[model samples]
Target: MAGMVEQVGPPGRDDITAYAAERTGGASVRVGALAPLTRPGWVQAGRHLLAGMELAVSEVNDGGGIAGRPLELVVRDTAADPRRAGAAVEELAGLGVAALAGEYHSVVARAAARAHALGLPFLCSSAVLDALTEEPTDRVARLSPPQSHGWQVYADFLLRAGHERIALATEPSVYWASGAGILREYVAPRGGTVIELDARALTPAGLCDELAGHRASALLLLAGHPEPAVSIVRSVRRDPRLAEVTIGAPAGQPEFAEWATLLGDEGTAIPFLRYLPERLSPLGARVEAALRARLAHPPSFVAFEGYDTIAVLADALRAGGAGRTRPAADWSRVTVEGTRGRIRFSRTPGISVWQWTGAPVQVVDRDPSEPGRFRVLHGG
Candidate 1:
């Protein structure tokens, strides 16, 4: 498979005629994938995600597929809209998909509550809202760390970096709010003070002026989207008063390269928590090479996540057999090796549902001179 990583072509089709002797006969297992494919906010990332999913599906089919059955992905554009996401779930369910995956927005993932209600297994690829997996559901599992866990990683990094007073610049969304709340919860009890600011209401110059009045060591941008976070970063770079203050954002993970491109030299040294580190494992190197061969640029963390989601689903289908609902116990026992590390899901103490808690979160920074180089500061 190492030599085949760079092979670019259409995925192989399962030959049902050649598999007539198989016990159950050959068939394609359809998996539903919901992503904001055409939405302006997430289209680029969504495309990379789709590519990753396709790569996994291709690899699976190449290896003779699950029990001689091919895996087919039926993707739909949710547009990051909750109503549209709900409709997509119903449509995929109507199509009789064996499983579901790929949701980028927390709001859209929440709207996919129909998957839980319908007893369809949904492996969430990237949505990080804490509430998405806060309640137990036999049919739902999230591969990404929750927003609270990511914030906890960032908060710990800040504390370790000697930041005592933190300023939170947040967008007006449930995702951002949940992240901010988690950051405060983690920081406050540890003798750190957090001051909140409205990221959406403030202009670049206005944010600089507001930050000048506060005596904070660092500013944590909790905006889930790139616009406000990019605005905040540009403002901080332009203002001399904020020169010494470290600017960071957990939401910057998916769009780090794009933000770095836009910010140029100003983007350097801005710490952010990313699920995958700058350094790739041997498996990650192969995945990266494969992605670079197919994509215009290198794949993002979400792309790797998309690949992992489908890979896990393939494992579930194999372990539980096709067209059958596996008990949550059986699903919990299934694990696969991912690009980052070992992938597994478990119900944590605070979080009520099963989720992949072992996110290889690392605080990374863009290099000042190297165009695409990133330095891993801590963790992972």
Candidate 2:
């Protein structure tokens, strides 16, 4: 029976405690949210991520919450910095958050060592580094496939598309490095050859020259950021010799509209590995509508992942109650209907930790006429 509560500025320890006290009336479940709210590179993505988390929290509270206790989010800004991320987790722990979620950068998620140390259940929303959940731990889980698994899916798509020689290009980052490594490991054994290129170091002319020099049937641009990937694709498409080369990117998955607009005609028919299906589930539809109403755009992959993270956490809380250690075990058995598909987790191969392995991985391309619409080439 409490009125809607709103707080201005970034949440601090005292802010979180006071907000929860005012909103929950002393009986609420607090989930910690660590994201890059003001980071230079990740501010927009961070906003959408927070929006999704808020949507999920609102829906859970509207539905009587977990075991009739209101769910509250204690948000902190990490700015995608590793040290800040680790400290944010520690701060959240000090605030007595039952679980933690919301991180977009792999470097930041890697700093989740504190979550393991504190034994608080941490669900990574969108960080895709393979090592995030590589080690077995009862306190950690990820909702997105690791870079290796996602790249393997991309490799399979390329193989099925009759492309044998693939050129891999990427920026210098841990996220892209893990993806490139997986592409190399997966492509060679499958009778495919990979030509690797450092996209960050390449000038537009140099990129075109390199693409012209290689007889690659397709180019896999794995830049973790969108600008480099868009630049590479735009440059490659201009080369007459490589005019027909199939272009794909993992970076475009999160921010598809910007990539598509930057590439223009060049973006058509290009494949990208994405976490969500082209179509939404009933829950997905509701989330998309809510996002459109709130943010004036449909939920992006980051938003969907964020929504699912809290949904999964709520399910775990409902089953195990608050303050229960080892919620990862409970998370492993939870199968919530998410925006993408039926959300579930299992121990990832090679990583040896429970992860949301069933995330809908699809190779989708932008519709030439409809800039925002994507057509699924493979998977669903």
Instruction: Give a tens-digit lDDT track for model 1, residues 1-380.
Output: 11011111223323322332252355567788877777444776777778788888878877877787767777788877889889888977887778888888887888885687787888889888877744677678888888777768778989999999999887777777788788889999999999988877888788778888987879877774457677678889888888789887667543446676677777777787778955678888898888878777878788898888888888988888767355322458768888877888887766545688877787777767774777777773
**Clash tally for model 2:** 0
Model 2 residue runs over 4 Å out of place are 1-24, 324-329
Q: For model 1, what is the error of residue 322's alpha carbon versus the real structure, in angstroms, after optimal superposition?
A: 2.3
Model 1 stretches with alpha carbons more than 4 Å out: 1-26, 253-255, 277-279, 324-329
| lDDT tens digits, residue span 34-83, model 2 | 77877445776787888888888888888877676678887778886898
Question: What is the TM-score of each predicted model, taking all chains together?
Answer: 0.88, 0.88
TM-score, predicted candidate 2 vs. hidden true structure: 0.88
